[model samples]
Target: MNFDYKLFEMINQFAGQNQILDQTVMLFSKFGPILFGLVFVWLWFSKSGKKVDNRKIVLYAITITVFALGVNKVIELMYFRPRPFVTYAVNLLSDKTSTDPSFPSNHSAGAFAMAWALFWHRKRIGSVLLIMAFFMALSRIYIGVHYPFDVTAGAIIALIVTAVLISQRRLLDPLYQNILQAFRKSKGQKYYRNM
Candidate 1:
């Protein structure tokens, strides 16, 4: 009945007929996180002592993503909307059932947060990551998992939170540095200590 659900159904209908597109969206929806994670690792380890502090950038990106996802969980609890598949007989291409709330998609939030964080460090990589994030968000809808508003709200939330966090680096850097030092002391996975 709502415009959001109407749009969700419209978008989801496109995939029901195209098996290949559905499969592609499903695969992207499933593996997008890993793909972004690998890219983050690549960005961190492939630094050639350039002007940018790759390690710090990577650390901040991770921090922003975690924080955004936490915020998403709180939002989910405050405003619970069932998944589209639950209310309608949608051609659910994804394996995810209608168990989680629909509004404020976590996938979109995490993806955009990382993309924005990456953008803060390097424009080219960040732009590409943002495109990937957009596709990831679209894939969720195509696979009949999230509504348009859910993805939109998630992206908006991530963008705002990530921008604020990055802008307040003076406040956040100390916390990140303290954590890094503590982790380093544990002799865990060793990484660049220049942060």
Candidate 2:
């Protein structure tokens, strides 16, 4: 508990230091989730060899992220933790404020879900996403909207969710296949038939 505050202090200490650095981190924290979705879209349309498998992987990752986010919402309802800025005297960067509970960050949970999901299949892409996800999670702390434990808990939740979903791949396989087949037959997706 004490260590959580110390770790958060170490990270949030950087806030209000420099405009350029703060701006960069703020941008990452804001758009990191959107970037993850865009990456999946890009992967779906890429000329990569394993088109079918890539699409399936994208679906799996998306499902995991969505599932983790749902879990976060439920957890927030049961256990509410105030934002750091709301509780302490800290350097708050962004002007935004949230009524939502701070424990188990939704941003970190969803981002890490995508990162860990992709990491299992595409190491290079997954590694890059994972790194970006970490920085994004750290940025949340720097902005003083979340404690370090919030992001850490979020990441742990993502790990557990990813593990559970991956283990149930068999249940997901036929669903992915059927969805892909239906999508392939849709208008403007004729080329997907060969994929």
Root-mean-square deviation of every model: 2.8, 1.6
lDDT of each: 0.85, 0.89
Across 11-110, the per-residue lDDT of candidate 1 in tens digits comes to 8889878778777788899999999999878876774663236667788888889889999999888888888888888878886595889888999999
- Candidate 1 regions exceeding 4 Å error are 49-52, 177-195
What's the residue-level lDDT of 119 in candidate 2? 95
In candidate 2, stretches whose alpha carbon ends up further than 4 angstroms from where it belongs are: 188-194
Error of 2 at 47 (Å): 1.0
lDDT of 1: 0.85
| Candidate 2's TM-score | 0.95
